[model samples]
Target: MPKIIEYPKGNFKNSLDLAEAVSSLGGSCDRESCAHKMGLKMSGAFGTKIGTTAKYELITTEKGKLQITELYKLIKNAYNDVERKKFETEAFLKPEVFNKLYDRFKGSELPVGMLSKLLIREYDVEEKQAVPVSKYFIDGLQYLNLLDGNNNLLDYNKSLEVEDDYAEIEDENDLPIKSNYSSPYLPEKPTAQILHIENKNNTTNRVEAETTDFIVHIMGPGIDSQIVIKEEEDLLIVDAMLKKVKKKLQ
Candidate 1:
């Protein structure tokens, strides 16, 4: 028998409610306490709320306790609407299935009429759950303004760019990175100490930066590539490329 993929049984708003409840109890509480805070009884229905909040990556169950995640705290304590919405978008897209949908239909009109069929056919959504899952996904997009009035999905990062002069950034190390552009394979922050050794033959001096938050776009005749390094592990790709170049030169 084919494996049944897991999805949030409740909608996005319901999950948010569960998150709020978890927050009310000092960000972590026992299952019964959390359910009571949400005015929900200790039952399977309440379990679904917990499960759905977890699906959005807002809360985690640790040692029989439901705890709101740091993402949730960031959203709850966001200083401005833009910051809040950015974190909300992150929460909404946390699920693997939801991320898959966003990637497939980003900057394109959602197939509203055929979404259910598409979900089941392409995304492994169960036959019985295709409709509701599609509905919830669309609802989340609408709530987060990810879906525009004409049904075309907005560019996730472009829509959330923080407009500012940024002329005098307080910390030189804190690069202003667009949240959506972050890679899942990388650590959010990487720390490494660099040792510089002077060589008589080399005149180049290297300046080390704390993080890699820029995109490397290479375009030439019949060649187009975009390289994004969000963590130290990603440097292996660059190292391999340099090795190839050195071999060719040798």
Candidate 2:
């Protein structure tokens, strides 16, 4: 049997922040260059983070330096919001860590503590390490609107639920292929996932009162845009944390 590949979470604040920073870079650089551009110190922790990014192929190392992958550049150069999100979805879902986990659990709700234990048991990682890795996995996936407000998984096909105006959201019953690759951050499954958000405001004309709907194109393992409209006040992060329409369990 293939061993499950494992990697530490990179020190990019969060995966999305790291992607944003890399996009800001001129498409290629080293660890030092990456740190400098992000205005972060190139300490041991930073080095580990850089390594993590490379592990995922978001950035590659050449002659002991780093360079952005062509896929990521496509995302950075995307002409529109939905297209950019599609690239990001492809990048993240490329990792076996995301696919296997999503396959095993689908999009069911899971808390950090429980997930940590699963990691430890499945990969035989140290309990101390498993907890943090679990957190990283959950935190990173949030960038794609894969998780709900209470940590429940909203969807797994990497399908972002946009407004009804867009194509209908994908069905979670469509499961992904379980990853059998033993390499960390390697692509082992199909592409297609999600990232979405909805926002609202308060105004006299009731501008803020109306619900704001977003439409995104999920990349690898892609699916139709899933929709999840939120109340205006609940949309504190309307633009950031999008929305999800979970399949009602029987």
Name the best candidate (by lDDT): 1
What overall lDDT, based on C-alpha atoms, would model 2 receive against the true structure? 0.52
Q: State the lDDT of candidate 1 residue by residue for 162-204, as single tens digits.
A: 2111222232223322222233232345322222223423424
Off by over 4 Å in 1: 1-4, 162-250
Relative to the true structure, how large is the alpha-carbon lDDT of every model? 0.68, 0.52
Which candidate achieves the best TM-score against the true structure? 1
What lDDT does candidate 1 reach at residue 118?
A: 82
Q: For residues 1-250, write the lDDT of model 2, one tens digit per residue.
A: 2446665565323444555576677665666767777789979887777777766567777797667788767876886555766667666666666557766665566656678777767766577777777766776667665666666665533333332212232443222222121211212431222232122222232223233544232222323323233332122222222322322221
Using all chains and alpha carbons, the TM-scores for the candidates as numbered come to 0.62, 0.59
